[model samples]
Target: MTTGQMARAAEAPYYYVPPHSIYPIRGSLSMLATLLGAALWVNDFTVGPYLCIAGIISMLVTLYGWFGDAIGESEGGLNSKRIDVSYRWSMTWFIFSEVMFFSAFFGALWYTREVSTPWLSTLDSQTLLWPGFAGTWPNLGPAGTIAPFKTVSPFWLPTINTALLLSSAAAVTVAHHALRAANRSRTIFWLGLGILLGFAFVACQAYEYHEAYTELNLRFTSGAFGALFFMLTGFHGFHVIIGATVLSVIWWRVVRGDFTATHHFGFEGAAWYWHFVDVVWLGLYVFVYWM
Candidate 1:
């Protein structure tokens, strides 16, 4: 065994389990508060936004503490091979759940476009309910209901974001390889570049939203197209933000010598999430933008 492995085996138990903690309940309560606040916010309650922000803050704090403790345990050699395997499985299932979540939105878009919209066009009630109401993919409702809004074209901004995400994925892959090779400097360089590219993608997306609102008049209420447009892209952007945050944390850990060549599950987990985000963005770019 290598010196690092020998040291870890000597210091760590065969299978270590942590003591009872409050993180689960705290996280659950925070999520409940956030959901309640969202319900109220949608209903136009005055205190809704404040409560939502507070809940988000509480959730962030809970996550910080929980992950911090986990990091400490790993650094202190409390995490054994068994714990590492469990963590890998946990991350795998987490990414699978995310895939299912995105799949739901994609399914919604498909149903609306191919089945419901076309079916509505052929329905006899369309002529009775509203004369000359063409059931198009981006129908503006019965005349004056939805304002006319231009759809976002896949031009400079979204295309740029796609390139950025793709490049970041490549960079991170290189970083992972470098880490395996024990090239800390190269890993840091490439990983940092990847993280920056991710943030750049987010920035580009924010600007795209700004343009959609101000210039194109495309919004959540413009039409079904508008609503689905924002829902898919916005949620994907949120995932990008989350993936970037996780990668940033991993980058910090790498800088501090928190990972070794053979036992870097944390870094691997973060990379997996980043790759998932990249793949989701590609799907969004194709379906939402091109289609």
Candidate 2:
């Protein structure tokens, strides 16, 4: 078909093909299993880990199958400018919703820091009764809980990880621009570097968490600081994983000639999402950790 014809064909309503699919259901099943496994494992259930592994493998298979089909269609010109536009809109809306979600968490943090914690600390009734009340975000117990129970400081490793994540973000931006310039090698190299940087951030976080639990005695069950730290940083880690995955996919697509300098919204959208995630982590660092 001519380019115009192919474009028109792609613009045809998706209904023409009858939207029926098994992947979505199958994918959900795998996710459910994995979620159950995680829940059970966290509670020290015996069967949880086995189910989680099985679920993860199943999910990987499902993703491979589904993405393979989409890739084939895209490479075959079945996807047109219209599909690209739709994806752009979809991704934009999805990211915007995520922004609002994170904003709510940030708002909660603001209220807690500025209003709730101070209010709770000054209550004479509590101090009169529970005399040892420390009134802190990360409440320590048993008077001197020692080194393990100490509050985490953002000065050392956390700062390093912050730099790592921000640097990776810049590298990803470079790679994105390289893609638009049709500089394949530059794109791949920068993207690969970004992925490495992402891995480094995750590794540092893993070590930090280990130290927090073992040496610092901070945990999700600890108190406000612990709760906020885990909630904000843990979610940010998940987003980093996703961003890395997107970058990896873009790298592979580059190798396969799936995108062009003129029309590669998929690559651009993923880049945008990664940058958004990076920005969120910046906010997390300032509000959740440094503040």
Candidate 3:
């Protein structure tokens, strides 16, 4: 072969090195806009909502481009086994960090219910400090500072959502198995079903939120109970949306023949994330809802 042809046929490097990209900077700026806009919006600023929407759009665009680049690299055989191992470790740590994130919120909920509220109500100075205060799991604060609000029950909607998420988990697992078996059609079908189930879960949650705000009169300002309730569930809902989006992208890639049975770390990574989300939802169902 000619020298030029030989050069062209050279194997990829042992470790793929990606060039510098502006995706990170763009992502950071997008998050900044989102957080700042949300803060201002909560404080009743007029322009906050628009800025928040803009930020979300910007972030989505950035992620699209970033993932596109990664997909290109993988498809072009730039990623070696070493690179794949690195990706796995990175995802592992990312999931671990998410575990800690949820732990903090769950710990707060536990502390409020088991320790803080009970201790405050039991204090000898309570009579002088705040009369007519009752130590309750869903306290409306002393002297009724917060309006009366009912806590959500886990009977119908939450239960239904739980089932939907569980089914989605199962569907994704089936899809993974199909991919391993090199059954592309079955994989696509199951993945699509999983994405649908995810959307259904989100829809159910949205309806639940509407019921809380409209019928039950519960809101973010409804004392500690409301605060913790929204914090936990809202964050979980955000994660569900994110997980669904990730799965949708993976589904698209699968459709484009981006993965093979033996080499689909992208698919595996997304599946791992989806499973993590499912497990977290189970925890929420037990502690946040049923409890």
Q: Pick the winner on TM-score between candidates 1 and 3.
A: 1
**Across residues 90-180, which tens digit of lDDT does each residue of candidate 3 receive?**
9999999999999999999999989988877866748667766788888989888999899899999989999999999999999999999
lDDT, model 2, position 119: 60
Off by over 4 Å in 3: 1-13
- Model 2, which residues run further than 4 Å from truth? 1-19, 124-132, 141-148
Q: C-alpha displacement of 57 in model 1, angstroms?
A: 1.0
lDDT of 1: 0.89
Highest TM-score scorer: 1
Model 2: how far residue 65 lies from native, Å: 1.8
lDDT of 2 by residue, 1-291 (tens): 246645655675652232477999999999999999989998999999999999999999999888788666665566656676767899999999999988877887787767766665665835654455555654553253423356668888888988998899899889888988989889889988998998899889899889988887788866556677788888888888878887888778887777767657768888888889888988987777667
TM-score of 2: 0.85
Q: State the C-alpha lDDT per candidate.
A: 0.89, 0.78, 0.89
Sort order, TM-score high to low = 1, 3, 2
Clashes of each: 0, 2, 0
Q: If scored against the real structure, what TM-score would every candidate get?
A: 0.94, 0.85, 0.93
- Residue 84, candidate 3: C-alpha displacement in angstroms: 0.3
lDDT score, candidate 1, position 117: 74
